[model samples]
Target chain A: MAQQTNNFSNWISQQIEADTTFTLSDAVRSPSRSRLAEGIFPTRKDEEWRYTPLGQILESSPDMDSRSAVTPEFINKLKDAMPQAHTLVFINGQYSENFSDNQTHLENAGLRISRFSQLNSTQLQMVEETILNAALTDDNIFQHITLGLAQNGLFIELAQNVDTQTTLHIIHISSAQGDTSFTNPVQVVRCGENSHLKMVEQFTSLGQAAVITVPASYIQMDKGAGLVHYKIGIENNETNHVSNTSVRVAESGTYQSHQYLLGSKLTRSNLEVSFTGPDGHAVLRGIYLGDENQHLDMRTYMDHAHPHCSSDQHFRGILNGHARGVFNGMVLVRKDAQKTDAQQTNKNLLLSRDARVDTKPQLEIFADDVKCAHGATIGELDPDALFYLQSRGIGKKDAALMLTRAFAAEISQEIELISLQDYLQDKIAASLNEIVNASI
Target chain B: MLSIKNLQVSVEDKPILKGLNLEVKAGEIHAIMGPNGSGKSTLAHVLSGREGYRVDAGTAYYKGLNLLEMAPEIRAREGMFLAFQYPIEIPGVNNTSFLKKALNEIRKHNGEEELDAIDFLSLIKKQMNLVEMKENLLRRPVNQGFSGGEKKRNEILQMAVLNPTLAILDETDSGLDIDALRIVAGGVNKLRSADNAFVVITHYQRLLDYIVPDFVHVLSDGQIIKSGTKELALELEERGYDWLVDKAETQA
Candidate 1:
């Protein structure tokens, strides 16, 4: 076990040195290495990871080699998929400056988009203080790995009161040639006071090779700021993804996270949102679809530390074949956090007999005046509803697809961006089609 | 044209329909009314190929096809429709999309060209008016959060859109008010034609008053004990099911 732990750190240290395309100051590097050494990889014995066994994944460690270039063909495919958004392409976790678009317009709008390696000393200090300091926790070894080993990533900062009209689309692609490689990319976002910004992160793989992606994002929303964020992971079927998202919301600030997981052999996403001031609000929504031998696990923690703050968390999962899913959501209201309103709901649909799901919605409210409600449900498609549709000339397969689509639509309906919503709808349909075809 | 002979059905080993027999020709409206536990629902579900019911004996023929041999959707494609007693609320399936798909599936099965979006919208709009369903209901999920009256109306609207040759309405008037009942029956009355038939199953004579049945059959303990014309419904309403139960028992 100790030897395995050493290998993880030694591998990360090697990557950090070999990939110098993006530069990081020693101030940012030394602490991340110490933090990575502070913890070991978690196992099923860990309460939060009980449903997802990671023995096989940790055994197959990935190599972090030289950065790859984003091909024009890949850029064209992404443009065809999402034509309206301002796109930023990343190949093997290294930012591709040549392929990115809409930089001038974004710059004029008071949005500073730079590579993480390009940060000056003062900027690096700010990142070290804001993100690296807060993101490294005891249970999140992957987050430590991401911050410590990542080569190059995007750093976005919005000026105070500036509203970004166009959404910034960040596309992270793992090249097929990078077989058994690690792509640990970290993104830092700071929305200034009363500012507004929307961004989407897409994790995809270009080839059939298996890869391990460890991406971490830290977002800080200033007073009255509003930030809409989406993280979509549709990597290769053999890929294993672990993403960590930590958010801090100031007074009256709004933070919304929309995450959809469709591919990958194993996926674990951790989202933690903390309200620093009163009357802040946060909304976290996720929909995960797993098929074949996929294992999907998502954990969410919402902390209402200030009075009159409100938070809502909802997650739905659809598992088929031999797939398994786990959703553990916790909402906490401190003793002085009175008048806090928090609602959490987790619903899962198991399409095959072998498919399984474990959902736990936990709420710990120390404030007596707070109104918090949480619910969790796991079941197959409603037989009665299926019969109702079948009675109207819809085939059994078509009826099942409709019900599956309906189940997913609950999460999709809350998406604020039409283009992202449309893209997700197609993904949901394709997943449902695969499920139906497999059953037949 | 439909015919059933000695149909025996059971649910989970509990017999619900025993030696049930009935017949209905095209252009005629047949109303099956009876007391509780008379297997009216089971008959409707069995005809529509619901999953649970098992036909232990006998056969049902619809237009020379073995009705029991086909699946639910196949039965629907063969022009058979059943308005559920408890309409399910499918949260995200829009009423318009559900109806359009159903209409197209039926049309495709009949070797007729499927209607385009414009024609489908027009057809559904006309049928929606027939059932007095508001246009907004079309945008909402199928029967989701719909009032009792609205769900029944939606079911009738589907019947109108699909134009089934034989429609079996199972307790469609159970939860409806008098006004909703009138609108639902009015829609059914308009769909009556020489090329199609209706089998309206109910527990009361009230629904029969609007959609005047050409023949009325009283089902008791899974079998039809009596048959008469429209006047029989009124007689049963006045005398109650007990009088007929005693008469049928003494005769048996």
Candidate 2:
């Protein structure tokens, strides 16, 4: 296992070294390159990765030369979810200008959305500073790999007090036909003082593409600002997705995030949020539905470094057909962060006997005056609940579907966007229907 | 409308219902009075096809069809409704949608066209009024966070909407105040028709005051020990069940 970890790190380092077209600045690349050169990758022995095995990700070599095309109809269907938003498409980690919307109107409205390659010197410096200032306590090798090898991503900035009504929807499509593809997209989002921004990022793949996606994102919310971010991952079953996101909220600011992981052979999402000033708030909600040997892992770290800050997290998982899910969450209240209110909850449903879930919710409160609570639950559908519905004339399968959909609706309904919420609920129901039918 | 012959049941090899028998025809309302641990709930559960209950012997026939052979849903579609004593609180399933689905499923089984949203809303609104249910309860999840009275009222509301042929009320008056009991019994009376029958199971004679039963049966040790007219309930309420239990034991 140790040798395999070393080989995976070495392979990533070699990929970085061989790419002559690495366009990121030296400041961004050198630290990640040196870190990769250290060749210390995580194994099952590591506490943070005890439940997730990276064997499938390590064995498949990423083919950088392979490129496939996405049909316009498929892109249009994705766009229909957020039709009024500013849509940006990424194919194989490279921004597709032909498919993306023109952002001149947004630029005129003091909202800046630029590709990393097109960022000016000032904006690039801001991106670099945000990455450097992120409060990520459990930074792993995948983040460094993304920083060193990232080819293209967006750099979005909202001016002070500019609460744009239009959302920014970023769609990443991996279209690799024969060989396994690799993509590392680094996103930087900065919301100025008193600004509000809503962004939805969707990751999907074409056909049964073998893709490895290691993406990193850094977000900064200024005083009194608010950011609502949503991520939906619906990649092919042969794909491996590993992503890290770090966020910092200033005084009176709010950061809300919702993630839906519905597909992928293996997925590991690491999210960290810290309150840099007093009176900040964070709300996190997510759902991971896996079926048929899929492995989905979610890790979250909430740091209450300022007083009067509150964080609430609720995540759920539904697994079937030998699927496995893991939720490892930690909420840390610093000594000086008095009167902090932090709550973390995780609930999982295992539909089949072979399906499994490992949930651990932890809270470390150094502050004497704080309200901190964490809970984890794993169980099957309540037979009483099922019979209640069945006795009402609903078929057994339909009753099961209704109950499962209700389980997901608790989280999906929290999404503020109506269209996106409907889209996700439909996807969840479709996937659950397939699982129920197959199991029956 | 319903018939049971020597219906014996056990849970985990422990007998709960030992040779229970009952017969009901259209338009008849029969009240089964029993003490606690007398297999009252077991009979209700067994009739509804709940799991964990073994039917040791006997058969339940509904309209000349084998009721025990059908799934719970099939039994329901065949116009059998069981109003639970303690309604299951199902979070996330909206009450309105659940009722709509149930009603439509039954309608489809009867070769009738399904109700659209507008028609369903109208139908449910009427039923809601019949049970005096709060309008907000329709939007909430099924029975979640509901008061005991409200849950029972919701069950009556469902019974009214479903309009089952053979409706079994399993101690629906257990958790209700007098006023709630009056309203619930009133709702059941409103829905009573010549084409339908009811089996009201309760331990108290108070509910019988509101919805008077045509016949009263004393159930003891899983079997109906005494059968009499509605005056028998008042007699038992005045004299208590010990005299009857003692008489039945002496006869046995």
Candidate 3:
């Protein structure tokens, strides 16, 4: 039983064939599916890994279990933000249509949002059409996990010229505690030509158990369209968070993402955006706070595929108590993509003797007329500054917390929602206080 | 109000200050003039308790208390100020915040209440114009991207606000132009009174034209070889330290 040769793909094929929500074809027989599984399923030799070895996670083969009941505490958090916006709530990856719905009201019949468990044949066809019509042609790893094992998720659509003023909130709460309980959540958002959508997402794990949640999201921004996306990851240390989100910006469109990961035992985030047409712009920012042997890993790719586009990226991490971090960012400029302006910077502060951070900023530029600059700094708390603060009678812990909060101030204030920003600020400050106190 | 007796120091085991002695009573300006490598800055570092300066044998007194017995900030609170020749640059720490912290620390040490933010801001704004400094520098990081003259003027502006009983300007006129030097010295001149003493350290006699010290002392090999009136500074400007070196050699 320890060395069983029964691959999950064979089981996956049988499971889907028996199920009524999906249909299999000759395409499923190909090796691409297994290869994608092997890729996202961590092996010991992966370089993007090494620190976060998944051998421990795959020991029992965590599969989504029976749907978890949403608690009143989580319900209140979701209701506080967007009481009127069409919301989608998922408890342990199963979409709850009673509390949140996508197709309640729409300007046009074609524009809608629905949970994965309630999708019709036409909705599956629409997914096939969007995947076929867009630039994504390859079978990716995260997508493989989404289709093969994920139980339930969300699907969103915005028809041409349909602008929604309400903010769409996707709230994912997990209580995966016992054996063989892993949750994979998927969200697909598509904005038609000249359409607009605002997304506010929150990922939280209830304070019960050690669970792993892998969320994969795809957003398609059409020509002359715009999207404002903010993601808050407040998973406690018992949760291992893995998310891969990609956006395709059409001609002259605007897309932006703001990410905040307060603390987790292990976190792997992959964010990518492509400028599919000219005159596109993207703003990306991320902040992570790690302590007490927690490991946070993030890799981002900003593909400047079109001419006359601009992108800005800045990420900050505060680590303490042997916590390690990795930030790998790549900005790719194609040959014909001229007059592109891109800037990237990563700054991390190590607050303990054993804390470490590895940051690599990669730029692969083929064009000659682009302005690209990237720099990273890894440093400790300045003694002079600490002493300066201590000399003012501010306790050492308060001083350290203040400096850590100041390190993340510019980006935390960038969050559009005032309450969300303050919430994150308090969370980060509390984490810093914990680190400072434990050191003493 | 201050005294230093047999103050000896070294850098990397090589002796720099050999029994340097100096005294300043209240309401007096004492100028310590010397050649390029005469331990003038080493004296300032030792007095300020900057790390890595070996105080071999020395004693410094301010208002009859053990001056070097406390941390730099505490020494500063006891009305002893050393205007750094090259101020340290601290990025992300607001200049106004830095001054406010230092001011409050000094005030708290003296058993006085710290001023509120509104009062502190108004007080700093008043000093900003006194030193001909733009208020913009106060908003940015401390001493970051400041020009040589601006850094010097900022130091004096701090001196004006702290209102120390004993102010030591350690080559405050080193890199300043004529206009900046005159304005800086004018600011110091306004703070001059019977209660506060001054120590102006310099290698050149040009600053003497504005500050006009009451006593001029020549520091050679870390000891004051001679003490004279302001006319001696004029004489040293004409004859130079080379003349003094020749006279010491012939006398030896």
Candidate 4:
């Protein structure tokens, strides 16, 4: 069994050796190289990755194949679906200048914007330092793999007291053509004191071939800064997505993350937030839909390290057609973190008898004065409710779709951007209809 | 017009309705009164096509169509409605949205254009006055956290909005107070016409006072043992059910 496990990692290493394009940047070349050589892929024995099978992802890689290109028209089609924002496009892990817009205008307004390759040597050093600091606390192997494999990524910074009224949209499109491929895209964001920024990260694939995406985001917020981050991952059926997201908040800072997972054969997302200063607040909300033998997992960790900090986590999921889901949330209050208030709730609705969910919400408090609560529930759609809607003359499928949409509406309604909220609501409705119709 | 002959129904392999027969015509209000385990609600469930009810032998005809052969929504679209004794509480679906979907689906089945938001609101606002239901209830989730009277009133509100040809009230007045019963009955009365009909099921004679049924039927062991004009309800109330059960057994 152990030898069988080693086979997949050895195959990955061999594939990495055969690919010349996969190289580390000059700033942290040696460290990233050693990290890559350390074999970041975890086996089933690892507690955090026990439920997710890594061998399936390893066996699907086409490391020796060439990267497929995307056209400008394809990017424009994607941009038209999103709300008005500064759009940044990346194809197969590399920034595409031909498809992106508004970089110069944003830079002129004191908003630092650049691709990883566009950054100067000093900027590269800063990125390396940030990666090192984040590595100290992040035990996720996917994050290190992203650090080792990512060639270019979007980097943004806001000056003190500067607010970008418009959102920053990042679209990552992966095209593997007929070959299996992998893409690692990283993003680093810094918000200065009293500044505010809203960003949307969208991941999509264009080809029929299998693709593996290891995406990571590292965000730092200074005193009184605020950041609203939303991520929508709608990959193809043959794709695997592993996302690692971390946010650090300073004194009186605020961070909110809205994650919507719609499609992927297998997806795993890890979101972590830590309060390093007093009076920091974090709101984490997510809703996911799983269909057709898919496996979706979400893990969240909230750390309250200072006094007078608060965090709330709300996650809901709908699974149908033999799909499976997992939600594990933990909120920890340190010894010195008094007056810490943390709340977490996870609810799941399964549409079929075969559909299943495993959810656990844990709260750990070491502080003397703190309030923490967590709850989780898994249930199927109420037959009485379905019959009620059907008796009102709504079709069986339509009734089910309406209930699923209502279940997802709680999370989508929290979006501050009205247009984005409407856009996501439509997507959710369409996807639910498709899932219900297909089952019939 | 509705007709049933030798209808026998079972739930979980246990028979509930055994060889029951009844007929209801347009412009008629039929009140079905019986004791607690008399399968009053079972008739309502069987008519609405609720799951888990197996018809061992029966033929129910609604406008020359086989009612039991259709799905629940089809039965609803075919102008059949059931006001549940216990209305379901859906926590996230808005009341207005739920009603509009139901209304439009029924209209579409009848080859009529669906009502837009503005038109639907206008129509619902008028019906809301009949039930004396507050407008704020439309903004909340369907029956979620609603009081018992509010839930029953909401059911009547739905019946008014749908305007089905055949409406079955299954113990709708059980949890209602006297004023609420008057309002709910008034709403049902307002919707009455020569082209539509109602089947009012109740355990007490008080609801019949407001609705004023044209015919009253006593159900026992899933069969209509005794049926008469409106005075039968008054007699059943005056003498209680023991006298009727003994009479039914003696006649059998």
lDDT (Cα atoms) of all candidates against the true structure:
0.87, 0.92, 0.77, 0.86
Candidate 3 per-residue C-alpha lDDT over A148-222 given as tens digits, one digit per residue, 9 for 90 to 100: 554555678888887777678788777665544566777778888888788888888765566767777878888
Q: Report i-RMS for every model.
A: 0.6, 0.5, 4.1, 0.7
What tens digits encode model 4's per-residue C-alpha lDDT throughout A232-280? 9889988889999888899999999999898888899999899989999
TM-score of 4: 0.93
Give stretches of model 3 more than 4 Å off: A1-40, A50-52, A60-89, A95-113, A118-143, A159-165, A176-181, A194-198, A383-403, A436-440, B11-15, B63-69, B80-82, B245-252
What DockQ results for candidate 3?
A: 0.20
Candidate 1 displacement at residue A281 in angstroms:
1.2
Q: Which CAPRI category fits model 1?
A: high
Docking class of 2: high
Q: Tens-digit lDDT track for model 1 on A117-138?
A: 6788777766766775454333
Q: Is candidate 1 or 3 superior in TM-score? A: 1
Model 2: lDDT to the true structure: 0.92
lDDT of 4: 0.86
lDDT of 3 by residue, B140-205 (tens): 877889999999998898888888888888899999999999999999999999999899999899
- Candidate 2 regions exceeding 4 Å error are A1-7
Deviation in Å, model 3, residue A96 alpha carbon: 5.6
Q: After superposition, how far is residue A164 of candidate 1 from its true place, in Å?
A: 1.1
Provide the TM-score for each candidate, comma-separated.
0.96, 0.98, 0.84, 0.93
DockQ of 2: 0.92
Enumerate the chain B TM-scores of all models.
Answer: 0.98, 0.99, 0.96, 0.98
TM-score of chain A of 4: 0.93
Query: What ordering of candidates by lDDT runs from best to worst?
Result: 2, 1, 4, 3
User: Fraction of true inter-chain Cα contacts (below 8 Å) kept per model?
Assistant: 0.87, 0.88, 0.08, 0.83
